[model samples]
Target: MAVDPRGADLARLISEDPGGPVVMLNLLRFAPDGAAAYQEYSRRAAEFLHKYGGRVLYGGQGSTALVAETGQAWDAVLVVWYPSRDAFSSMVADPGYLEITSLRTQALSEAVLQATVPWPGFGES
Candidate 1:
């Protein structure tokens, strides 16, 4: 499976920008012995994330799923919040960041990166 985003993917991500902050939800399925590599990637990625005003909101290994389709279990989950879609784009486009992304690519067998939008009345009447 393709682990890296393509030009079209970036374009779509930019076009879908709703303005303001964006929280990215990542669902990852690791390759054999991939956790270590991913850890390295995460460590290196922190600098770039911070440079772009992004931070990890949550990150954890996946556990038992009470409800899910077959073959839908993920190995890990991460939620990263960015100041804006542009910030995310900039980070990914950075030359240094791109150089280190191979670690992330090699570590994941499959992954889902989704940008989440906050609902205005999500928690209030």
Candidate 2:
């Protein structure tokens, strides 16, 4: 699911609890002020996420490759891991998160938050 800055359509998506493993990704585009603000928000939000079994698997302003079948380019990436879809939903429902959402919407030029089901080939070694 993609939530734009407007955040007008999150009501239905946030209400459902699918109860399976979930990954929440925050894709950060280049904006010095926005990046700084999001980092601060992320630090605080991480604390709250842990209470409900949300583990931040990886987060950084690091290089990553995005090959688009539709032919596009993406810059930096941030990823968080949640125990289950229910846990993911709970994180968003938290009162503190509501406040943070306002800040995130402003900081991020565009944000794509999606629910993913791991492929069978995922995590192969």
Which ten residues in a row are the worst by lDDT in model 1?
116-125
Per-candidate TM equals: 0.95, 0.72
Residue 106 of model 2, lDDT score: 59
lDDT of 1 by residue, 10-87 (tens): 899999888999999999999999999999999999999999999999999999988999999999999999999999
The 10 consecutive residues of candidate 2 with the worst lDDT sum are 1-10
For model 1, the local distance difference test gives 0.94
Model 2 C-alpha lDDT versus the unseen true structure: 0.65
lDDT of each: 0.94, 0.65
Error of 1 at 82 (Å): 0.2
Best by lDDT: 1
Candidate with best TM-score: 1
Q: Which stretches of candidate 1 lie over 4 Å from their true place?
A: 123-125
